[model samples]
Target: MLDWLIIGGGIHGTHAALRLTAQAGVAADRVRLLDPQPSLLARWTQCTGNVQMPFLRSPVVHHIGLSAFELFEFSRTPEGKRFAAFAPPYDRPAYALFQAHCHHLLTQHRLPELHIQSKAVGLHRMGERGWRVETPAGGLDARRVVLALGLSDQPAYPAWTAALASSGAPVRHVFDPNFRAAELGDWQQAVVFGGGISAAQLALALAARQPGTVTLLLPHPLRIHQFDSDPGWLGPKYMRAFEAERSLDRRRRMIREARHRGSVPKDVAQNLRLAAQRRELRLCEAQVLDAQPTDAHRIQLHLSPGDSLETDCLLLATGFDGRRPGGAWLDAAVATYELPIAPCGYPVVSRALRWARGLYVMGPLAELELGPTARNIAGARKAADRLAQVAERRRTGHQVTAA
Candidate 1:
């Protein structure tokens, strides 16, 4: 039996394992991280693969290492010196630098084996001691379980997606991992949806491949405006303001306003304009109403400037569902043992993010505990750190003699 069973081995699960073994004094062998991927950080390929972004929206302190400055300290070492310029604490760090810093730490750790290519089917609780996790490999008895699932589990296709899918169309939200962007061929026109940073990056990426062949569709007017995440909410100031509101309705409204609903930062905004100026990209304001297949080879999209359009392909950068992943794991687990699910389909977690019977949650699901940013990388660290402390306490309290 492992001391901790952390599901999802991306940044969240990795942090949980690292903090538990290295910092919290839990034996390394006692920690088990189970993820379906063959390696870590694979999900970022779809999200951040286009242009190498400089300047992370988050600061250096918000990273994967155990200590707050562990990333900074590692950056100065030989493996990390290449990224030292981006490590200046006072300045906003670069994405490439941050990514490199994280990779460097992963290398230093010599890649701990926490089981790869494993998907957790769900979980069941032992009578009192721990939880039982079902994996493709077999069953794992863990003293504590941490749900560190990432954004991939909850890809939020637009509402119209279901209608289109039911209509038996080639249409699909870009979040489908099977839909390979590189597989696209010579097409005269394609539409990339959304107005946020992702929309811009995808438009730029597609245009560079096909050249003057793609258009961007946004539901609203372009602002040439800069919208990084809210700075006030980074710490306690603005966060507490949202927290103080007792009503979930008010809290939801405040969260919406606090996050970037559909906007890009200054740098990304400029990059999109540059991509357009190169005559490879075009941006338009229009809403997508319905999409259906004209044939196996073509799709007709009904648009709501009150018109229609045809496209070779469509990409939806809309984001993910706050609800559970479209998988059997959540529903199966809930049904198997009767777990309490919030009306939103998210697990109602304690302030420490434990679900029921000592099973905990992290990442996007932990948003209610840590606030709106809980889906981001920094929030991953926070979730892992907190869960580690809880797991540590439980493990120490339960050591049994061979007698």
Candidate 2:
């Protein structure tokens, strides 16, 4: 049996595995990261590349490495200084620089050897032994399991997209794993939906490629916020009050309110405005009420305020679904194991992100405990810190492990 089996080899899972081996003294051979992708952070790379995002919204310090300042220190290295590493305001690292730093860490620690390219379909307790995770290849036994699943698998499509697709219109979500921006085909006009950073970046990219041929349709005026949530949520400034709250419903509300949903950063917003002024991109502020295929190659989108648009391609940068991830397999596990969930159907995990005995959660699952930043890179670091403490206590012969 493995010492730790992490399901999902994205940012959260990679960070968890690194923390276990590097800080908790767990043998790298004993820890495994299970993901459907062939490599770690593949989905992250794909999604960011699809949008042509230049820099990350997160700061340079928020990375998957063992130390908080590792990325910052890397900036001073010869390789890191090759390109534009950090942006202004908050020193947000360029996407290329961030990925390079992550690659360095993964290679230095040999974390890729711990990866198992398989999807975890089922999970069940093994009584006193530990837990068994069911995959297509077979079942793997582990003393502990961390569900580090991300929201990438659950892309949120607008309601009108289904009908438009059925009518033979070209509509795609930017975050779809199979949706390649390079294969978007030659189109006279393209409509990029959503008002968030991804939509803005994608619109800018499309406009730059084909000036005066791209339109950004925003449901509302573009909201400008540097980060998704206030930086206070990362530390005890906002987290202290959040942790003191005993009500999960209230906590959910707090998270929703704290998140700056469908918003862009100041830099991105500024760039978008400049593109609009240059006539390279057209910005429209109105909700898409419905859409219909005007012909085989054209779609007429009915917008709010009695306006309509005809376009050859429609790209949705709409984010992921708000539903709990892991689908029916996880629902079955939750029912069979009787794991405690909040009223919103999210995991009610402990401070260490433990949901059940020997079972932990990260990403969206740990939101209630980690606060609004639970789905970001900083949350992964926070989770690693908590899990490291647990692993250290376990190493020292502590037995209080029940959640």
Candidate 3:
């Protein structure tokens, strides 16, 4: 049995492992990170690479390292200086810099040695001992379990997407596992659906690849926000008030209000404006009412309030569906373990993100407690702090012994 088994080896899981072994004094050998990806952050790499994102919307303090200034400190180094591209106040690291920093951390810690490249399909409590996780390859028994699943796997598709998909035209969700931007061939016209940063990036990418070939279909005019949410949520100001809410339903409502729904960062908005000026990208305010396949191997999107647009390709950058996380695996675990779920289909977890004794949650699953930032990299940092405290306390009490 291992001391800790962390599911989903993306940002949250990877960061938690780092906190446990490096900061919290948990031995690396005693912890195992389970993810289906062959390597850590593979999905993250793919999703970001697919859109050709430039700089991170997040700040320098938000990273995978144990210290808050770790990334900032690295930025001062000669090699690291090449990665620095900030816009003041918020030291928005370039995507390459952020990725390199993550890789440096992984290499320094030998994190790959602690990874188990398998999908956790099932999880069950082992009574007084611990928990047992079932994967296609084998089973893992751990004294403690942390479900650090972030939102990489859950892609949001509207009801009308099914019709478009069955129509067999060139329609694909940006986060679809099988779809790759590089795989696409010559296309005269392209349409990207959604109003968020993903759509902006995709629109720009397609336009740059083939100028005047991309149309950004938006349900509403794009909104601008420097960060995903206000920074007050990161500290006690907003959190104190949020925690004081006492009602889970109200907390959920607060989260919905706090989030910058369907918005892009300032830089993205500026770039998009430039693209529109150059006539390389077309931005339209319209809702997709329906989609039909054309004989020319294309899609015709019917819009609301009356209009239509035809395109050779369609990319849904509509973001992830927050209502469902973990999918079948979560449903199975909830059924078997009798875990409590909120009305939104998210797990009902404790302040420490505990689903049960020795079983915990992080990332979006902890949204009720972590608030709107729960799905972002900053949320991973907050989750790490909470879980690390719990893990440390549990270790000191011998409530969970290392195997």
Candidate 4:
């Protein structure tokens, strides 16, 4: 029996595991973190590749530290800082520095307690106040659980993708495991889809890789704005306003407006334009109406304007569709004995983040309580604080229970 079982050992899992260890009064040996990957952030290798990301969109103060200045203080030391110092009063650290800091923190903490290299099979309530998690290795009894799954792995392909696949040449989404940028042999022309930072970065990556060029297809009439939402969304200025909203629909609308996921930065846009001007790339506002595979394995893209574009490949970079708790795993694991979920698909919880007897939700699922930033790195701290407060009360025999 384990004291805690944290699923998906990404950044959220890392922090939550540490906090859980502290709260449960258990050593690392007693805690278990189940992740499909051998190392943390295995999914983020592409986004943080040797790319020169000027500064993080997030603030420097918001970090995985006991104190806000912990990362800053660590930045002054040798292994502490990887990127150069931020020139003057800027509060944002270079993205490189942030990645480096994360590396240092994970290594320093020797995290990933009881790392399970297999995937989660499912989850179900065990006894009166515990959970029995099913995995490739079999069942493990846990006193608490946390979900840290991210959005990147689950790419949202438009329904037309399959219809397009029926075409002579099939289009592939960027998130496909078999999609390799290096082996794009003899394929000069390609169509890249989506309008988020991922799409922009992938376009830049693809453009950099080939002597040939790629076209970025967008739905919007104009190139989306960089840093589209206010940085203040991270702080209380906009967050409090969002929190004060009484209706979930109203709040979700705010999320839709503020979640500027696919916007490219100015530098990336410059690269795309330079590639275009040099005849290495083309940027267009045409949407992908349909897709199909040709006899020679090339993709045939049918545009909205009654025009057809044939390319060696079509990479859909569209982001994830709606995701909350409860999918196949939840369906398989959650028995009829657990607390009821809200209509929106997330576990209905108190302000402390607990869903049932010993089950808690930490990452994106916390949106109902933490608002729009629930999936961001900063939200980890807020979750930690809330869970920690409850842990303290429980330590003193408070016996916090589900509503």
Candidate 5:
């Protein structure tokens, strides 16, 4: 049996594994990262590439490394100094630089050897022994398990997209793992549906390629925010009050209010403005009421303000669904183990991020306990810190359980 098995090899899972091995003194060989992708952060790379995002929204300090200063210190190195490494305002690392730093960490620690390229299909407790995670290859036993699933798997598609897809129109969600933006063949008209940074970046990319033929469809005027949420959420500033709130419903409301949904950064907004001024992109602020396929291999979107638009390609950067991830497999596990979930269906983890006796959570599952930043890189780091403490206690012969 493995000492720790983390399901999902994205940012959260990779961070958790690194923390357990490097900081918590857990044997590297005893922990495993279970994921469907062939490599760690594959989905992140794919999604970011799909949008052609130049830099991350999060600051340079928020990464899957041991120290907050690691990435900054790396920037001083010859290798890290090559690219246009850091952006202004918050020193957000360029995507390429961030990827290179991640590669360095993974190689230095040999974390890739811990990867198991298989999707976890089911999870069940095995009594005193621990837990058993079901995968297509077989079941793997672990003393502890961490569910580090992210929201990317649950791509949000607007209701109107269904009809357009049924009519054989070219409609794709930018975050879809298989959706390759470069593979999109020659198209005279393209429409991107969303208002967030992803939509803005994708619109800018398409506009550069097709110019004047790309339109960004938004439900509201563009709003600019440097980060998705206030930086206060990262530390005790906002978190102290959030942790004191006992009501889960109110906490959920606070999280929703704190997130700057469907907004972009100032730089991205500026680029969009430049694109519009140059006639490279069109911005339309209206709700999509319905959609249909036109006879000429196009899609016609009916707008709420008595307007209509037609395009050869309709791309959705609408973000991910708000539903609890892990799907039926997780639902089954929840039912079987009677894990405590909030009214919103997310796990009610402890301060240490333990969902149960031996099961821990990260990313979306730890949101209620970790606050609004629970799905970002900062949250992953925080969750890993807490979990590392738990591992240390276990190693020192202290029995720890879900609070």
Candidate 6:
């Protein structure tokens, strides 16, 4: 039996494994991280590359490392010197440099050896407080389990998307595994639906790749924000207010109101503006009511307030639905264990991020406990810090300092 079995080898899982061995004094051989991808952050790499994102929206301090200052200190090193600044005020790190820093952490920590490239199909309690994780290869018993499953892999489809499918139109979500940006070759016109950073990035990519016009259909006008949510959420400034809300439903409402939803960075918005000025992009503030496939390999989009658009291809840059993270796996696990889930479909984890028994969770599922930053890289570190403390206390029977 393993000491710890972390599900989902993305940023959260990888960082949790590192914390368990390094800070919590757990044996390296006793911890295992399970993911479907052949390598760590494979889906993240593919999704970022698909839209050709130049820089990360998050700051340099947010990374898969113990110290927040590690990346900043690394910026002064020879290997990290290749990094370039994004813009003023925010000064986001270049995506390549960020990735290089991650590779360095993996090598420094020897994280690759801890990875198990398999999907966790089922999770159930075993003897006493232990867990039995089921996979296609076999079952692995573990003393504890940490669900680090990030929800980025699950692509969400709008209600109108079903009509498009019924009409036999060629439509694809940007996060679909089989949808390749390169496969959109020789298209004369394309339409993108979304108003977030991914939508902005994909529209720019389409404009650059396709020969003809590209239109971006958004339900609301573009709102530019430095980060996904207010920087205040990163600290106790907004978090204190968030914690004061006693009701979970009220907390959910606070999270929604705090987030600058469907917004993009200033740089991304500028790029889209430049593309529009060049006559290669069209920005439409309209809702897609329905869609049907027309003859000649085109799709007819029925917009709100008596508007319509015809395009050769339609792409949904919309992201995944948070209410249902990994769909079946999470549903089955929640149902089997009778986990305490909020009405909004998120887990109501303990202060130490424990879900039930020996099972713990981080990332989006821990939002109610960790606040708005729960899904970002920074939240992974915070969750790791808390979890490491728990593991250390369990191991040494003494008070442990924060990592």
Runs in model 4 deviating more than 4 A are 22-26, 46-56, 62-66, 70-74, 80-82, 85-95, 164-170, 177-186, 222-229, 266-271, 332-335, 396-403
Q: Write the per-residue lDDT of candidate 6 for residues 105-132, one digit (tens) a residue.
A: 8899899899999998888788585999
Taken over the whole model, the C-alpha lDDT of each candidate is 0.71, 0.91, 0.86, 0.68, 0.91, 0.83
For candidate 5, write residues 88-160 as lDDT tens digits: 8889999888988999899999999999999988998999788999999999999999999999998998877
Model 5 reaches what TM-score against the true structure?
Answer: 0.97
What local lDDT does model 3 show for residue 181? 77
Residue pairs with clashing backbones, model 6: none
| lDDT winner, 2 or 6 | 2
Clash number for each model? 2, 0, 0, 14, 0, 0
Per-residue lDDT tens digits of candidate 3, residues 1-403?
8999999898999999999998887989999999988899888888888888878889888999989999988888786788867654487888888988899899999999999999988888899899999999878999899988877677889898887776677888889877787788888789999999989998998999999988999989889988879999988989999988877888889999999988998888999999999999999998888988885479889998899999988899988877657768778879887888877777777777888777888888889889989889999999999878877876687553221
Error at 141, model 5, angstroms: 0.3
TM-score, every prediction: 0.85, 0.98, 0.95, 0.85, 0.97, 0.93
Query: Candidate 5, 290: how far from true, in Å?
Result: 1.1
After the best TM-score superposition of candidate 6, give how far the Cα of residue 198 lies from its true spot, in angstroms.
Answer: 0.7
Which prediction has more favorable TM-score, 3 or 5? 5
- Put down candidate 4 lDDT per residue, 1-403, tens digits, no spaces: 7767888777677777667565445567767788777676665544334222456655677666556777688788887555746522346677667778777777766774467777777787877768888888898788777776666566688877765655545466666545554455545687778876666666666766764567878766444554546567767888888878777667677876787666765655776778778866677877668666666567777888887778876777786667764467775544465555555666556777877778777777777767667777777888877776665566667866541
| C-alpha root-mean-square deviation, each candidate | 4.2, 1.2, 2.4, 3.4, 1.3, 2.4
